[model samples]
Target: MTRNVARNRSPFSIWLAVISLCTAGLVGTYVLFVEAPPPRRIVIATGGKDGAYYRFAQLYANLLKSEGITLEVRSTQGSVENLKLLMDDDSDVRVAFVQTGIANSEQCDSLEALASLYREPLWIFYRGSKGIDRLTQLKQQRIAIGPEGSGTRGIALQLLKANGLGEKDDEFSALAGNLAAEALERGEIDVAFFVAGVDAKYVRKLLRDPEIHLAELTHAEAYERQFRFLSAVKIDEGLLDLQQNIPSHQIVLIAPAATLVAHRSLHPALVSLLLKVATKVHQQGDLLSNVGEFPSPKLTDLPLNPEAERYFRSGPPVLQRFMPFWLASMLDRLKIMIIPLIMLLMPLMRVAPPLVRWQTRRKIYLWYAELRRIDLRSIDGMTIEEADSSLEHLHRLEQQIARIGVPLSYMEEYYNLRLHLNLVRSRVLSILRGEAGHSQPGSHPGFRTEGGESTLAR
Candidate 1:
């Protein structure tokens, strides 16, 4: 019973050791395979309450929230300030809705566009009697160039200044979207400019009234020539209201596209997810946009992220669906570990049998050394009984070789070495018993004599 207990305990102990080893291996594998933690929440830098960016964020925030992602929409001074927030480390803001023409300076870095949400049309509305045929006409007039630090203000100031107008040329008022539109309607301002997306809610309400008239960019071609980034778009004469035929002629407008920009450090999976969401939110049939019309990764002030570039062309990875976001992240991290694993595992599977054969034949090889020694003793004319004792030692070694445990993969080579050991043992014994004369070690007698002399001398 005690023997039985000990035997049972031995296997248990071995199993425990195996379990411990496997557990350690599993833990190490998990450490290597485990994914990074997902981001807790994302902060989006949007424009002020009355602008298109803030309204767009409301929709995007809803879309991202549905994907288990929290979006903190922080109101800012529009594109320029949004870019600043993205650059500032303490802000923790990850994404921004920036109008394209705003970021003109060279100080920006580590930014990439996820997609172009919409075209931020530079809506220039003037009081009917101001007699403004071009942007230059607004010179020396009371003009509201949008709020300070706003995207509209930045682009408006730049465009008007190109036509030789600035704060000095006109009575510039820095006011919010609703406030500016209201001031223009009340005749408090001669002209008001809003660089916002198409059918801007506030601008539309003002345009519907008879008191305010929408200004057309008569010099759109010249504007596009001066600013290559600006595109000359024509708002059809009655496109806004086909039945009413509201405008008498086509309205030519110079506009900049709005870009969905993010920091370069954003995870590829997250970028892919954002891009996917942007596609669904912007490209799909929504109130303000049409199908196949949005989420363009092209209109950005900064360079495109490589993943965003690839995703724009090829789309998302398949493993992203089945794998957790964090796990998919790990595959990207350990991209280098794959080569070493393949190299090490291949030789282990292929050469294991050879390694076992080498080990099993080691004892048999040792006996060959002994047989050589006994053969030398016979060559030196040692007595038969003395040589027999060496033969007996070799026989014991042969028995020991047969008792060794080796897997069947190595059995052929093991048995072949055993056969060689037996044949050599018999040959040495026959010579020792004087049953056969001296057999040369090989074909060379001088080499054999020298080898035998050296063995006897040793």
Candidate 2:
């Protein structure tokens, strides 16, 4: 009974071992893949509230809100200020609409571009058709080159330096947007350099003004070649207004793309969410771009984010395409655990059942060793008393064999062990009969065994 009780733990212990292996694999997988959840709220630096950057940022914020993220818009002076906010390590602005050329390679170490959303045209408006078609023509003139630290100032300064404008001092007005346009109307500045979208109120107003002429950049292709970030755009005549023939002729201009940039340390999940928002907000065409031309990963201002690179290369992961954004993101994180979990389970599944069967077979096979010992003992020549002793021992062995328990699958082996026991019993009984026959002279040979069976006849 003690042996049976002790041996019964084999199957239970094996199962426990399988459970432990599964648990350890799961824990290791979880450790490797689990990460802090993406921030629920974030801030983006958009340019002036009335500008295109701010307008498009609102669209991003609106779409992000549907995904359970709060988008706070931090308005700044322009793209230069936006870039500064993104570069600041202590700032909360993780995203911004940055102009392509405003930041240099050295300053972009901590910045990454999610995509280029649209073109931010550099519009040069002046008081006359001086046919002023080049950057060198307005060197010493009183010009409104937007405010200090604005994208307009950045591009204008670069162009001035490239064109050999030696005294690039405040020969320029520090005005921008409506103020610059108002100044141009009042003849306060001879020329105004405004970097804005095609639909900007001031840009449209300046374009229609009869006194102000939009300068046609004749060397646009050269500028594009020199500054790789610039793309030469052709604005066809009458495209803006058919009846009025606004501009009255085709105009060529050089412009930089408006990039959606973020800090390098921004969370990857948040990056994924921002990419989706970019697609929703900027996938359509504007006056200059064709439909689905923007929100492109190509020629972005800052280094392209790794996730954005993969997204543009092969598209979103399958889960993201079919499931909700948050749901798919969570599943993506958990996906790393699947292979390890399966690896742990497969071996346990393959080995455990066979191990249990071998353990059960051991229980039955152990009795065969005992049966062989008893069968050998029965063949020894012995007196009637020895024969009676051997018969009693065999009877006790049969009782134990009957008590052996096994599963339904092992029942055949269980019964087979008992049959062998009975065969050994018959051999012992024959020896007892032979001994009793030889000692028939003793009257006391009519002895009874433990079960009240008299041994006189057999």
Candidate 1: where is the Cα deviation over 4 Å?
A: 1-38, 285-290, 321-327, 330-336, 351-458
lDDT of 2 at 297: 87
Please identify model 2 stretches exceeding 4 Å from their true place: 1-16, 33-39, 128-131, 166-168, 269-272, 359-406, 414-458
lDDT of 2 by residue, 81-131 (tens): 888888888889999888889877676798888898888789999997678
Best by lDDT: 2
- Residue pairs in clash, model 2: none
Location of the lowest summed lDDT over 10 successive residues in candidate 2: 1-10
* TM-scores, one per candidate: 0.69, 0.77
lDDT of each: 0.70, 0.81
